[model samples]
Target: MPLLNGDEEISGVLRKYRNIAVVGISDKPDRDSYRVASYLREHGYSIIPVNPTLKEWNGIRAYPSLSSIPGDLKVEVVDIFRKPEAVTEVVREGLQLKPRVFWMQEGVVNREAADLAVQNGVDVVMDRCMMKEHRRLLGGK
Candidate 1:
């Protein structure tokens, strides 16, 4: 199998996992990361915000990095919103959590990062928006 899978695998990922650590998430409601995270949260998925710039948002504490989220949090998915160049580091750190999936949000792609995640027994998705995929594949808005 390739480092990243196709749509069928993506749909299975979206359906099977719910705890998402949104890296590079912005507190600003207008930002794409915030919007995507909020969408996921509204759809009944747990959203864990990860950004060094914030201590917390709304009420849930925002972790500074994937490595900082508590061990008991059970992050099922690591949804990355950082630039392509920054993904490798995030993937390396998030591997510790042993998440089921490493998802790079729309326009984000790093083959190296994806390969590392796949090699470690995690599914990978690159350059795709989870919100959009859910809507398209699962018949959401």
Candidate 2:
């Protein structure tokens, strides 16, 4: 199945899932990934920052990768901020984690990755920003 629009389903996912793994999250405040992660954290979602080069950001520990996060963080969403070509790898890794939703950021879409996620029984959202969807649907910033 192809990726779906983040409408009612996304809202439900966001409301139901509180812990999120932010792949490719940047330490720089100027980056959209950082801004979105911050927004999610501010809105009461627990964010696990995934960046290989960073150890910490905004007072939270940053894991080098998804597998590095210890003890079933119970992650519900995997928000990816990497390039389109890199999405397949992240999708493969996310499948191992078994998050409820796999989200590719705005302008990042890979049909193969989305299909792979769907095949693994994970809900997929491509070419969409999680922050925008949250604000539009959940009245969050």
Best by TM-score: 1
In candidate 1, how many clashes are counted? 0
TM-score of each: 0.95, 0.95
Give each model's whole-structure lDDT.
0.89, 0.88
Q: Which stretches of candidate 1 lie over 4 Å from their true place?
A: none
For residues 1-141, write the lDDT of model 1, one tens digit per residue: 344557788888888898999999998999999888888888989999999999986578999988889999999999999989999999999999999889999899899998889889988888999999999998876
Query: How do the residues 1-141 of candidate 2 rate in per-residue lDDT, one tens digit apiece?
Result: 346673877788778889999999999999999999999999999999999999998889999998888865888889999999999999987787888889899999898999999998888888888899889998984
The list of candidate 2 runs beyond 4 A from truth reads none
**What C-alpha lDDT does candidate 1 achieve relative to the native structure?**
0.89
